[model samples]
Target: MPFQGRVVDIAVDEVDLGAAGVVRREYTNHPGSVIVVALDDDGNVLLLRQYRHPVGAFLWELPAGLLDIDGEDPHIAAARELAEEADVRAARWDVLVDLLPSPGGSNEATRVFLARDLTPVPEPERHTREAEEADMVAVPVPLEEAAALALAGHLHNGPTVSGILAAVIGRANSWRTLRPVTSPWEYRRN
Candidate 1:
């Protein structure tokens, strides 16, 4: 173990900014994560009403997961999370937005993907979910409705809020302006 903590670590950096002199900065080190905006044919975006024990509420969030798998690409992790949590796959994917959820306190950057061309995973191949995920309720809300809720502050999840708003913008642009799924991500771990 690299010191202590779950899913994060305390890191300190000593740097000199020219005339600013030396400074010691402390922050949380995170492996980063990915959030998926899975849109189906009916223009509905899948959301998960997952209960968070720490928060004591069933937060509405997009399908997402930690980028902790050894050697897995960001896009791959996003896909896995979508299928595991939402029971679907995307034939098309693009980068919607990248977020630094808590830059002041942590280096936990996240990549949000706009996943379209949806297809259901066969029952035999469905993920065997456990923990909070097993009790997660999948809500397929219209994209416009989800966007409105997110903008209205009804959706409290950071990634979901940012991703839904960004996805709305991406759709207006006909998805041409979005980056490829394989585009380089600063937080990507090789």
Candidate 2:
């Protein structure tokens, strides 16, 4: 009754938590990660189409990945993933949101970043060690288009959709705050 759940078993990449109460617990312990909602100069959001085995489907999502084993910084991981997954790098980055995908079961925390001032990286690193190759494809869609897709249930991936909306709203608010005020002499006739 003292919260006595110890890791009874450990695998190469996961740990099994022995029963503490009425349930057996297992977790895939992963280093915290970052997701990048990269924006190109044309005001297009970058997305990737990748196959997710658990879902048995290919879905469109923002570029994301786990942190390096050596405990790399999340912001650096975001830039690294952007290059690795989409072959693009950004000159600017803003932290839009932080999320826990499943806090009750896992320790994975994902930081969502908004990347801008895009540039092409000379070479992108692919995860060759993964069981299945991640076929990375870059799709540039307008913010409005992404919002429409989300409303239509097409963009159902939680983090991806949330990142997109956060970026869109952040940009809108920034634009609204920075826009020049109209002069009384320049008022338009309705």
Candidate 3:
């Protein structure tokens, strides 16, 4: 490891490509993560407006979290993020999409789940927010509007845009493209 941080590690390695000969490469090793595209009955996607220090701006994004807890299922992680970030729980869950956001530079595999059958978490049971999340604002935007914003470059967060577009495609297909929540996650080493 060239450098190790709390959430990620930067690694430098030597690689051999038969045709190109040996080469050096550097990349980030991530713990993987799960994203929840929670949809209400009205077809509005739950989004959170939170400050991103790196960007120095608040961006709307789906409920998501890293799979940091050892042995925790991705499905459970998705559910936990939905509840913690959106104060809601979803009874219906399906795999919408899986992606490597930056394959060339990072091993950050993310699984986006389609969540429906929503119910609010009682106030007494809600998770207490902290840091940037403490000031996050939850907003529900219609699928079409979200897609438009994403296409317009207004929603710049990578996973948020991906999840929104995937939801749009899934909806168009009557959600037939969605896989079972327990579907195998090929990108995840765990």
Q: Each prediction's Cα lDDT score? A: 0.89, 0.71, 0.93
Give per-residue CA lDDT, model 1, range 98-138, as digits (tens).
88898888889999999999998999999999988898767
User: In candidate 1, which residue pairs get closer than 3 Å at backbone N, Cα or C atoms, i.e. clash?
Assistant: none
Q: On a 0 to 1 TM-score scale, where does candidate 1 land against the true structure?
A: 0.92
lDDT of 2 by residue, 1-190 (tens): 2232332122132334556434444554545667888988888999888888889988889998876546566677788888878888899877776677666656566778888899887653443324443556789999778878887899867889888888778888883422111212121111
By TM-score, highest first, what's the ranking? 3, 1, 2
- Residue-level lDDT of model 3, residues 1-190, one tens digit each, is 9799999999898999999999999999999999989999999999899888988898889999998999998999999999999999999999999999999999899999999999999999999999999977679999999999999999998999999999999999999999997888888867
Error of 1 at 108 (Å): 1.3
Q: lDDT: which is higher, 1 or 3?
A: 3
- Model 2 ranges off by over 4 Å: 1-28, 123-134, 175-190
lDDT of 1: 0.89
Candidate 1 differs from the real structure by a C-alpha RMSD in angstroms, to one decimal, of 1.8
Instruction: Give every collision pair in model 3.
Output: none
* Pairs in steric clash, model 2: none
Candidate 3 minimal-lDDT segment of 10 residues: 181-190
For model 1, the run of ten residues with the poorest summed lDDT: 1-10
Model 1, residue 25: displacement in angstroms?
Answer: 2.1
